[model samples]
Target chain A: MARMSTPPRGRPGRPVDPEIDSRVLSAALEVYSEVGWAGFTMNAVARRGGVGKAALYRRWPTRQDLFAAAINSLRTSGPVEITGSLYRDLTQTANRLINRFLGPHGMASIRALVDAKIYPDELGEALDYVRQSTIIGGRKIVLAAVDSGELPPDVSPSLIMDALAGTLVHRILLIPDTRRAQLAANPEPLVAQVVDLVLRGVGWQGTVSTRRTESGSGEPRTASEG
Target chain B: MARMSTPPRGRPGRPVDPEIDSRVLSAALEVYSEVGWAGFTMNAVARRGGVGKAALYRRWPTRQDLFAAAINSLRTSGPVEITGSLYRDLTQTANRLINRFLGPHGMASIRALVDAKIYPDELGEALDYVRQSTIIGGRKIVLAAVDSGELPPDVSPSLIMDALAGTLVHRILLIPDTRRAQLAANPEPLVAQVVDLVLRGVGWQGTVSTRRTESGSGEPRTASEG
Candidate 1:
């Protein structure tokens, strides 16, 4: 939990255990992903995590609070590190996104995104944390590339990042279950393919050697055909 | 709803009302969008559409059947007319996708996508229909463009379509509700910017006049600055 260490305001002596918070929050994401906002309840989360209802509520008073914390917690867990090169940075980021989306809590993410959009009046803030997870890091990479002369100044970070994220997601959405195992095993090639295309699209001119996928050319990334 | 006329296998004599099926399916999408798979109950859909549970169950025996049918029904509802010219066709299709994503049931579509990804056993086929609605038409346009000398023969349609879709969806996901009206009102400019960048990336060489967004340069498409 993002606030596991910081005790609740004006309330003293609440036991602060990172283990319980971590366990509960992880369970929160699992529950949210499985049941979504509609079916999300403190009892369900507590039951799933095997924590007491009091412990769950002590951390997050409401279901929405718990849901948002789970999403925001993404910032702390499994972050996609950013080095400088546009090609390498984007490839790394896309690889992380592909792997995460193919992970267990991916459904909760979808539900959160949908809930945020459909019920913006209620769930809009949920998207803020979600955006922070990838959009913030992605925009920084694009901006840094521009500053480093890899990309032009006139380009919109929104446009470039969207293109990258959009393509990755579209590929995920379109590929069937039959190909899923192969994709999960080899996200590098597909990530590289998308990054290269977007970099080319946005007019990035990197040296041939630093290009992404070819670096991960080991394993059954089979048929560098395209 | 996608098949109102066809009788159930070996189970006939059930009254067929296209009107009810349409209303019910429409409601199903709306309900599903608002409350995803977990909260998606036939009773909720029946109540939302004002149709009895018996009517819904009779037409479609299961929730998944109703859900899948609703997604597939998109094929008949909004056929993005595919004339020639890759640039024009993609812009039109992007425009439709943007508008639809901004529309009421867009959340449902997002849920369906996430559900399909997270629970392939349960929802993978939902994506097939979603892909057919956009991917099939997009590919046909790209293929036609390639054959007509507008694009190089070697360009992967998957790369191109993913670029287009990924960009649009990413934009939608990133923007807050505040700008949604402006985007929905004039998806043309944003659509054009994406199409132009992608087309340039893929090396499509259509003349300037045939470019998409400039045609919608009317009203506050504001400062055609991009």
Candidate 2:
């Protein structure tokens, strides 16, 4: 089944084995994570994959090309399935994203991308891919809720997504490890708070009871009611 | 008058002159902006400041110490003054921050900080300083509004600050130059939208007229009203 899912590689008109292509891409990610961009080399990937360097060159002529393909392969993780309620959907999705970013492979991949930013052309396209997959992917749920009349017509999915994902990244980057560990142990409270902020910002008219039920436990309001 | 503001320095209690201290700090920023982290050196700063390398090392034994001091010096730009209205206060602050990040010196300083992240301890303290000065500093206005009964008491200032600063950083990092240019050219619309989202999210009871008056040229609403 996995073999059937692999796409063919090499010259457009020429027949090439997909297994080799998949192995090479996987090996590329491993190499990147280990040595980062500074030490990432075609020879290292070819050796790690047990494939000829010529094969890699033929398939991806530049390091950027290979790095991009490796990033694409990382996207195999399935997208979040939309649940009926916006609060439920967003919280679940936020938890999954937080876990992904905090995980080792995800951290390494993100660091690699950050390293790539030193190169203007490479970083532009690479960052675009990340924004589309993460930010735009998250927005789809908000758009669906808007269409279904769950959220107000004025709700900007773009703004909501930016606020949602941006806050998550900020916490990850700025907060101490101890605090992050605590948040990770129970992300629901943080997730609930973020969703509440964004929903209110968008002026959602949904009952507060919905959020209360979703958060599992209610805490006293810290600021004015939205 | 300026001399009175200079703080005392040195363990010898010799009262190191503030003029030399400020000059060395300024020279450090100039060197960092020119070469970034990898090429940053104590000798370079000394040369730029026209001070002895011994003098530079006497005050700051390590590069990290000097870098931190230089970052501290940058903070002298002054905090955003409260303008009574939350919308005006936040937008004005946001514009200043966005402009700073987009500016050459700001860009260089951020890049240096990111480079410093390789040293976990150094980066943690450095990033914390940035978060306190920029993120927490921005939140004061929101807190004052809450205190003034302009916003709901339930609104979380921490969450709002995180969302606001995070979204700004996200936009700066993710969006292409062309789109950033557009936002930079006329930041009010974006600022207004962000503030509106935050206000509504917090459950502000003020007539939405406050936002309309602040936005200057109200656009048609695309989403549902709060």
Candidate 3:
């Protein structure tokens, strides 16, 4: 369905209400989770948010714009802060990411994006934005470690980022529901193992070797031990 | 729509033609790729295959059954064989997987399965079969390496499987088309990098260190290095 052709100009239109804007975005996320991208519509969102269709159209010219806004709202809840130690920082970030992904809102957004791949231009751009902000954001932490010599100078931040984020996403999307429930209950062990793998894979010399020595009872520590 | 309530018995029915059976399955795949799960139906498949609705219903009983059979047909292309060297084995398996996934039929099947998550029972079972075969098949190669002591005794096959397969799938599904095209052009370099990362992460001591020496450079090799 096409919206009004006239674009709302700054001076000619009434001021947009911030409260209504937030409400519409919230409702958009709820509707998206319930129906996914194929069923997602501006009409449904407007109805759910108790706003006029024209008001929804004025705020977001297209469904893709509304979807992006909804995703951004959900993403703003947690801010990734660097805690100095690469292991600690990665584990915390990964844990937060896993929690968000397993949540209903995050799961819905991801499902929609995955389905949106058929519409290359719109969905592709939205996917790229999410990857750049989230996956690339994670890469910055690894780069910080490389700069500080916590990891070898030759380490590829992009490759490390792929391995870390890739494994987590793979498990979420491909694994069974029971296994996913287990992961959601406690992601710390898996996060620890993934971080350890990245650290060792990058040839980091500090904490891993130290931790290896501490667990020197020689029974062969599990991948998550250190 | 409901099919016939009575289950067709083996002895009383007319002989089923293998040629017609294969044709219907092939047509099912094409229809699925065109419409995805949301629009998939037995009626469409029958029309596409040029078979009567009664014939199709008698054979498959349900859409899920037909969907499962179609997926199974696509999965029978090649079998994975181990070549002893962990790097060689993993690289080969990953390459094959990437090729299959990049192909039209593979992409369609994956897209349908992802969308099928909401169905949670019938389609979910079909997805589980694919994951067990493909992902678990990759795991067998790692388990072999561990058995031969090419990797450390303590390496977790599951974690390594997740990292290796996860990175490849992540790149395919999440990355942009240009990057995917680059990967498809020469998956060898990327596969080599992924294998190297997995080998190092699992603490393999032999070929990796030997390869490092043969390169003859004094600089330390990154995980992405061959």
Q: Give lDDT: candidate 1, residue A199.
A: 82
Give every prediction's interface RMSD: 1.5, 4.1, 2.7
- Flag regions of model 3 displaced more than 4 Å: A1-27, A30-36, A44-55, A208-226, B1-36, B43-59, B208-226
Write candidate 3's Cα lDDT for B1-226 as tens digits: 0111122222224439889988998899877765566667999999999999999988887888788778777766555777766777777777776786676565565565555556676577777767667565666665666555566656666677778877776667666676777777788877888888877887886684222213223433222201
Error of 2 at B86 (Å): 2.8
Q: Which is the leading candidate under TM-score?
A: 1
Candidate number with greatest lDDT: 1
Candidate lDDT scores, in order, read 0.71, 0.64, 0.68
Error of 1 at B65 (Å): 2.5
Model 3 interface RMSD over true interface Cα atoms: 2.7
Q: lDDT tens digits, residues A93-177, model 2?
A: 7777677656544444545444544445654565466556665566667666665556765666677777777777666666565
Q: What is the lDDT of residue B207 in candidate 1?
A: 58
lDDT of 1 by residue, B54-128 (tens): 878888788878887776654453545445456667777777677667776666676788777666777665566
Runs in model 2 lying further than 4 Å from the true structure:
A1-61, A105-118, A206-226, B1-60, B105-118, B135-139, B206-226
Error of 3 at A193 (Å): 1.0
Model 3 CA lDDT for position A176 = 76
Q: Candidate 2's error at B13, in angstroms?
A: 11
Over A1-226, each residue of candidate 1 has an lDDT whose tens digit, in order, gives 4633322232223539989988988998888887777788999999999999997778777777777778766545554554657877877777767766777675566567667877776677656656654555666676666665667667777787788778887777777778878988878888877877788778886654443323332322211100
Looking at model 1 chain B, report the run of 10 residues with the lowest lDDT sum.
B217-226
